[model samples]
Structures are given as structure tokens and as C-alpha cells.
Target: MIVEHAVLRVRPGQAAAFETAMAKARPLVTVQQGFLSIEVRPSCDDPEIYLLLIGWDRIESHRDGFRQSPDYPHWRALLHHFYDPMPVVNYYGRSIFHD
Candidate 1:
């Protein structure tokens, strides 16, 4: 599986709205081809920071497939405006693990 990580730094006081929008956006990604799962978690250390973990069967599904789909625009519209400096998104494949 490939994991896409987006370290979202939402503006202060915007966490609740960001989370609410993501709740609605999550299902859109779930229905896409090669989607495995989606997870969103708030940072304990920094309340304005949120971590998004998305599982995909292949890298292209995230980079090419999802971006090409119509749902992406909707997803962007719902969640893109909350970013403080905008999130940094990157994908990873399993490489090392302790457990």
C-alpha cells in the first residue's frame, strides 16, 4: 500500500470547521479506485495542526487518478481554504518499520 501524508496546518480557531469539512470530503476519496482508507487526526502537540493519512493501492491512483476525477474540485473547495500556510502533501511506500 502507498500512504499519502498531508500535514495540515489549519489557522487557529479553525480546527472544528476543518474537521467538519474533512468528514464530508472523506467519503469522496473512499469511493475512488484503489482507495484503501482515509484517516484524519488532530495534533496533540499543536491544536492547529492536523495529520491526514490516506491509503491507496498505488501511487498513481493518488497522483493521477484522483486529480483527474471531478470530485477533486469539490474536495479542494471544501477544505483548501483553511490552511494557514497551506499543507505539505507527500506520498510514501512502505520502506522501514520497527514493528
Candidate 2:
């Protein structure tokens, strides 16, 4: 499996709005092929920072499948504006220590 990670720095005072928009945008990604799950968490130290983790069967499932899909525009429209600077996304493979 692959894990996509992003540290979203939302505009100050817009965390609530961002979270609400994320909730609405969740379904867009969830319906994609190879999508497993997603978790969005707010930072305790920095209110404007959010951690987005999404599980996928492969990296291409996100880089190609979702990003190329028509749903991407809707997802981008809903949440992209809340970001102060664009988020940098990274992908990880399974943990080496995992059984």
C-alpha cells in the first residue's frame, strides 16, 4: 500500500472553513479506484496546520487516477483556496518494520 501525506497550512482563521470544506470534499476522493481511507487531523501546536493522510493501493492510483480524473477539479475548487501556500504532497510505502 501507499500512503500520501500532506501538511496543509491553511490561511489564518480559516481552519474551521477548511475542515468543513474537507469534509465535503472527502467523498470525491473516497470514490476513486484504489482508495482505501483518509484521515485529516488538526495540529495541536499550530491551529492553522492540518495533517492529511490517505491510503492507496499504489502511487499511481493517486498521481494518475485521481489527479487525472474529473473529480480533481471539484476537489481542488473546494479546498485549494483555503491554503496560504500550496501544500507539498509526498508518498510513502509500507513500513519496513511492519509485520
Candidate 2 residue lDDT tens string, 1-99: 899999999999999898889999999999999999999999999999999999999999999999999999999999999997999999999899967
Q: Whole-model Cα lDDT per candidate? A: 0.91, 0.96
Instruction: State every prediction's TM-score relative to the real structure.
Output: 0.93, 0.97
**Per-residue lDDT over 1-99 for candidate 1, one digit per residue giving the tens place of the 0 to 100 score:** 999999999988999998899989988899999999888888999999989999999999988999899999999999999997987889999869858
| Candidate 2, RMSD to the unseen true structure | 0.7
Top lDDT model? 2
Let me know the TM-score candidate 2 reaches against the reference structure.
0.97
Model 1 lDDT, residue 28, Cα:
85
